[model samples]
Target: MKEYEQNQQKNKEHYEKVYANYNLNNILYWLNNLEGYLDFVTNYETSWSALYQNDFRNRIKGKKVLEMGCGDCNNAAIMAALGARVYANDIASTSGKIVEQLNGSFDFSHPIVFVEGDFLNNDLASGSFDFVIGKAFLHHLSLPVEREFLKETARLLKTDGEARFFEPAVNSKLLDELRWYIPIGNRPSKFRGEAFRKWKEEDPHPDRSFSSAHFKKAVNEFFEECLIKPVGTLDRFRNLIKNRKWNGRYAKWALKNEQKLPLFLNSKFARSQLIVGKLPLK
Candidate 1:
């Protein structure tokens, strides 16, 4: 418990520093423009559109939705627009303020309730929400805490409710080995050594990546039925071509076709996984 409390404080301070510099005005601009919104979704959160956009529009209408670690409240805003009563939670106070600002800017049918606190200890009522979702949230926890978090998620959901998440995955041993050889500045991806080191310095909890097997083990321990889909089999290749003139075309093609790749290939090499699970019907 002592370690957990320390970790919580560390995470809170880290995110406070991170969100202090966030660009709410820029995000608001994107939210106001249709093409820009689409671009933002495609570039930063493609999995949302690919995995849950249709379901959110179709099944989430008039349902109660809870989003943990809702950074910037983008997904929560979308859920509210789709007619779900949304509760968005994050450790950073800035996130709550940002959500409030978004609420003021947009005419959403249902207003989003923003809660700023540790999610595990928040004052939200249990067995009340119809759906629980998070993106890149679970990976921030240590394995034991992640298991506890999943159990808490079960406790918070309606008997018939469901949970979904989009998380980073470590699928390829070859790529993992190669990553060590790439220098921080020369690395192809945006998350480099300096930024990672800074994050670690602020937070004691291990924000580790997951493999398909790791995700499955954790989900199965809490839920009886689940589906895990690996995505972005060609993301490294796409990253290689990201800055070239044909980057847009290549990204479009990759996004369209990556999921269609064979299950084995995706499981071994995809950059992330989308996990969907439901509580066992008692």
Candidate 2:
């Protein structure tokens, strides 16, 4: 195993904390550098969530679904709403319960299962899901770890099944650097919020942040058909511009006339990347 893979495996609890639990993730994420936090949120809403209603949910009707990182599985709820047999998993029990409460609220009649476990070592049978989704999940993997997980996803996905993924890219140096400062925006800033009194810390590995090109390469290594597009970062940028306290007016104008940006840092670079691929039929 490469050093990073070893490092990741050695820090099993750490990865679980970072990628597994949604509630703690919020606190840990708030502790990340401002730019890193910004990029993370942008990717979460746009890239990972790109499939929310229009794309993945619509396709899930009458299907069996497994959602990786099903933390607060809003998408899973949607799938159940569409008559899917949805199975959602996450390392974060708190968020799993949140998904439960949420589904209960909106889907009292639909059937959905929410499980909490370390997916890498969880004893789920191979080829269990008709479709496997890792929305906002794989970005937590380094390149090598991503490869391992992709292989695992391939193992779990049925011969004709698909695995979809979404993650923020450390694509542009300029934008990546700017990500550290993007506040969570739904509430007060983490740094400026209650965390100021609870913990004094920062992300241990900032260099591991990712970009779409890298994610696309990882997907191609295992899945036969991969589609990746920039979708989230643009929305976050939209949020940054539109928030009442931030640059909302400017964001409205920029979005209204978004074509003014230059060629290199066009809208794509400013968005999150989405990918979908199928296991080889062998």
Candidate 3:
């Protein structure tokens, strides 16, 4: 327990530094300039809002939403804009300030409160939230921590509320093997070597890339009803078309077609998984 506490503190400190150094201006510049492949890579929050339009605009309206590890709270901002009362939680103190800055940029219809603390041991009331969500957060945790975090999420959510997460999956054995062969210098131009080195130095938790089967097993242990959707096969191939003038159009077409493919194909080769689970009503 002592060692765990120390490690958590270290993780907290790392994130604090990350948020402190975060450049919103630089990010906006990249978003505006990165035409096709890079734009697709960086715009996940926008994609998520579009992907679950019905839920965001209707089902979760006027709902109490808790976003775990909400980083800069871009998703929380979206939820707030859609009329959900959002509680955005993160380990970094600077996260709240960033969220505040983000809130200032938009005319949000509902409240968004930034809660700074560990999600596993926060003072947030149990059975309080209508929906819980996270993106790109689960894979950063160790298996034990993931289990504990899910248990805590279950505890905090209302009996009928659902938890949703978008996480990276180790779906392709071939792609996984190929990753081992690709030299660091061969990476995309956007990933500068110095920036990559700095990120590696500051990142306390590296990607553990969960497999679909293992993640399903873990979720089943905590939730009664769970659905895991695997989407995107050969999705990374879009990167190859970066030099083409019609890269954005090709990337968009690839994305649309990838989602139409059968789940079996996606499960074998998809680069990510969207996991949704509901707690049984008492």
Model 3 is weakest, by summed lDDT over 10 consecutive residues, at 42-51
Model 1 Cα lDDT, one tens digit per residue, 1-282: 776777777777777776766666765665467355655566544565445643455598899999998877777876787678999999889888888788888887888899889888878777898989988789888877888888888888898898888887788878876754444342332246676556446544575658888888888887888888887677546655546657656766776687688889888887777888787333
Residue 21 accuracy (lDDT) in model 1: 61
Which runs in model 3 stand beyond 4 Å of their true positions? 21-55, 103-105, 180-203, 206-209, 280-282
lDDT (10s digit) by residue, model 2, range 108-149: 345678766656666777877788877777765566667777
How would you encode candidate 3's per-residue C-alpha lDDT over 1-282 as one tens digit per residue?
565576678878877876885656644443234344233543332245223533444677789999988886656765676678889999888889877776665556665788888787788888999888888788777777888888888888898988888887787777876654334443422235676556556557655657888888787787897888765465556555556656666656666677678878888887677788788333
lDDT over C-alpha atoms for residue 200 of model 3? 56
- TM-score of model 2 vs. true structure: 0.67
Which pairs, if any, clash in model 1?
none
Give me the runs in candidate 2 sitting further than 4 Å from their true place: 1-49, 99-110, 181-206, 232-236, 242-268
Quick one: ranking by lDDT, best first? Answer: 1, 3, 2
Q: What is the Cα-based lDDT of residue 146 in candidate 3?
A: 87
Q: Higher-TM-score candidate among 1 and 2?
A: 1
lDDT of 3 at 221: 80
